[model samples]
Target chain A: MGNRTPLYEEHLRANAKMVDFGGWDMPINYGSQIEEHNQVRQDAGMFDVSHMTIVDLSGDKVKPFLQYLLANNVDRLKDKGKALYTCMLNEQGGVIDDLIVYYLGETFYRMVVNAATREKDLAWIEKHAAAYDVTVNVRDDMAMIAVQGPNARDKAHKVLGVAIADQLVDIKPFFMREMGDVIVARTGYTGEDGYEIMLPANQAPGTWRQLVEAGVKPTGLGARDTLRLEAGMNLYGHDMDENTTPLESGLSWTVAWEPEDRDFIGRAALARQKSEGVKRKLVGLVLEDRGVLRDHQKVIVDGEEAGEITSGSFSPTLGKSIAFARVPASVGTHCQVDVRGKLLNARVVKLSFVRNGKPCIDV
Target chain B: MSNIPQELRFTKSHEWVKREEDGTLVIGITDHAQQLLGDLVFVEVPEAGSSFKDSDDCAVIESVKAASDVYCPVAGEVIESNEALADAPETINNDPYGDGWIFKLKPEDEGAYDGLMDADAYAEVVAEDEH
Candidate 1:
């Protein structure tokens, strides 16, 4: 059995059918997944993402420590409270995990890592922190709720009360601030404008209830998935795994290689990859038909095995099916997906399929 | 929706088998099964005129989240299928006990229905699994 979250009882009250996800009991959905998916796109939706681990790294060498640890350069966070999305890599240049790191101050930085990869992420951080004299504090005391969609901010402001609402509205994207025990970050995974709030675990159920009272619909991992995939974001275990590197996983842009000399954990290996060139690349697939695309399904290009779909779904926003696949770098603009033994044609386009309730691709 | 009507019996796998007025049987997944699987997006029903063993998989239902197989409740020959559902699959979620039924068959043996659960027994099974 999976460990229950602080909001387990609340989910039960809401009549959610719980499922075991990465050792955490989380709601699959309340009743209808399509209704919940549509709700987030059409209005405000809130999700309990408290199972995701939040870790605080502090001490004098924090900046330099992160500079060497993350695939993306930390120097980009010039302002306090700024956040950067990055990949933590292993010695082999494979992605250990992709996380969002918030630059809290000169001495402190906060990281939100995937729940499934929490153990490896901590061990990786601790192993490197030894040389840099940094202290890593895992913040199990915090519970997170992500309120998303077009009206997410306004609804959240109302629920948080006027005193902190105004400040929250003014908070920049990827930045967060603490108002007593409530930590509000203007960030989201759904490709929508919203806030991912981290508060005391004990206060989360109340906050979630308050947001629902203020008109934010409760969503689960089911919607969280379609939302993120539509945004062209890669899921940790599916799109990319320990065997894949950022270069091949469509995350090359996140790696900063300036000065070409300052070495990070995966720098040498990635540089070697750059020199050798790459064979595979991640691209988006929009089905030309009604069928849903599924993960690991073969992608056929010119009757050859070009690649496989890493993530696929029937997109509620587009009213069609779409996918993200890792195909041969030489694979061109089109391919076919083997769905239930039939090869259905698909169009290959730039990665993101949707953003902010709109299709990213040109019709 | 109604208590598994006494005229019918259910399988442990959650299929309902109803003995017809002619002594043949009609089969479908139960309301409990459809509720467990949320919105039905696609369904591959066993083609008409197919023969199957008691435990054979007769149909496949695919939802947005996962796919499930419907097992035949008793040995039978598939006589007809719910062909209209091919275009509109969500009918199962709407009426699993009626129009949502997958197929009709000629039962090989009448004794198989006795192995299935009654209304009260099926409810107990579901309630037992919930907690």
Candidate 2:
């Protein structure tokens, strides 16, 4: 048996097909994964993201501590409740984990990291935090739920009550606000308008039930993966890992290079790689042939094995297959993918294939 | 429990076979098999007139999650393939026993279909796999 979230019983009651995700027994789908994926795109859908790790940092030196710890300069977070997406890197410039850090106050910040990387992320933060006397408190008592889609905000606001909804109206994208013990953030992995709510663990099932009653469809991790892939967001372990740097993983924008004087961990290595020129790059591929692209498939450029797919899936929104692949930076408009020994044609396009319930690329 | 027709025969790999009145065989993945592979999106069946040995991988079925191979239950020559599934692969998920049949095959040995497991025995195979 794996670890269970606060809403595990709720998932069981909904007849969810449970799967082990990062040591947690999580829902993969209820009946159909494609239906769940479509639900998030067309209407309100909620996912239990409580398996993610939440940590609270505080103390007078917290701001300075973060500036050196994160690749992206924390200085960009000027306003309270502002969220910044950044990759925490090792000394060698490889990603330890990608996380969202929220600026709550001068001496306080909150971070949500991947569930699988929880132990390592906590240890890495604690190791570097000792010198600055920054306190790292894991908020294991909290549960997270992401409500997404065009109609998600309205439906979620109804369940959260009019008072909190009034305050949420002004919360801009990538921003967050706290209502007593509950934290509502206008953020999500899916490229859609949504709120990721963090609340007391005991209140999770009730809140989820209320959201369901308000017509927010219950989504699962399977849909979440497809949604994120469509948005061109990289999964930490799949797209990049300890051996690959952010520069080659389509995450160069997440690395802050300005303030040349700010020496964050892995900054020197990233700078050296940047000056040396990155050899490989991550790009999106759309299968023109009648087949589904999959991970680890060989990407054939000019009949040579030039790259490999990092993440691939059937795009329910587009009615086709799309993928993210790391290939030579010189790769052009077209390439062939070796699908089970047969070569199939694929078109190389920009990183994102869909955003905001619409196809970003020509279908 | 998945629906297992009493008159049909099955394989451990989850392929179902029905002996046609003309002595040819119609084969497809069992309902239990389709349920395990949720939401079929693409299917690649062998070309008509292709020959295969018993237990050979003859077709491919892809779902949103992953791809799986459909094995030939008996040595046979493919007489016809299901072309409609090229556009509507989910028909297998909707009706695995009827319109979803993957191919029509002429067995090299007339009695090969009778050697496959019956519904009661295939149920035991599924039961064992679940545990």
The numbered model that scores best in lDDT is: 2
User: Can you write out model 2's per-residue Cα lDDT over A149-268, one digit (the tens) per residue?
Assistant: 999999999999999999999889999999999999999999999999999999999999999999999999999999999999999899999888999999999999888899899998
Candidate 1: clashing residue pairs, number: 0
TM-scores for the candidates: 0.92, 0.99
TM-score, structure 2 vs. true = 0.99
Report, for every candidate in turn, its global Cα lDDT versus the true structure: 0.87, 0.95
Q: What DockQ does each listed candidate score? A: 0.57, 0.93
> What is the TM-score (0 to 1) of candidate 1?
0.92
Model 2 chain A scores worst on lDDT over the 10 consecutive residues at: A254-263
Residue-wise C-alpha lDDT for candidate 2, range B1-131, written one tens digit per residue: 68999989999999999998999999999999988898899999999999999999999999999999999999999999999999999999999999999999999998989899999999999999778
Shift of residue A255 alpha carbon in model 1, Å = 1.2
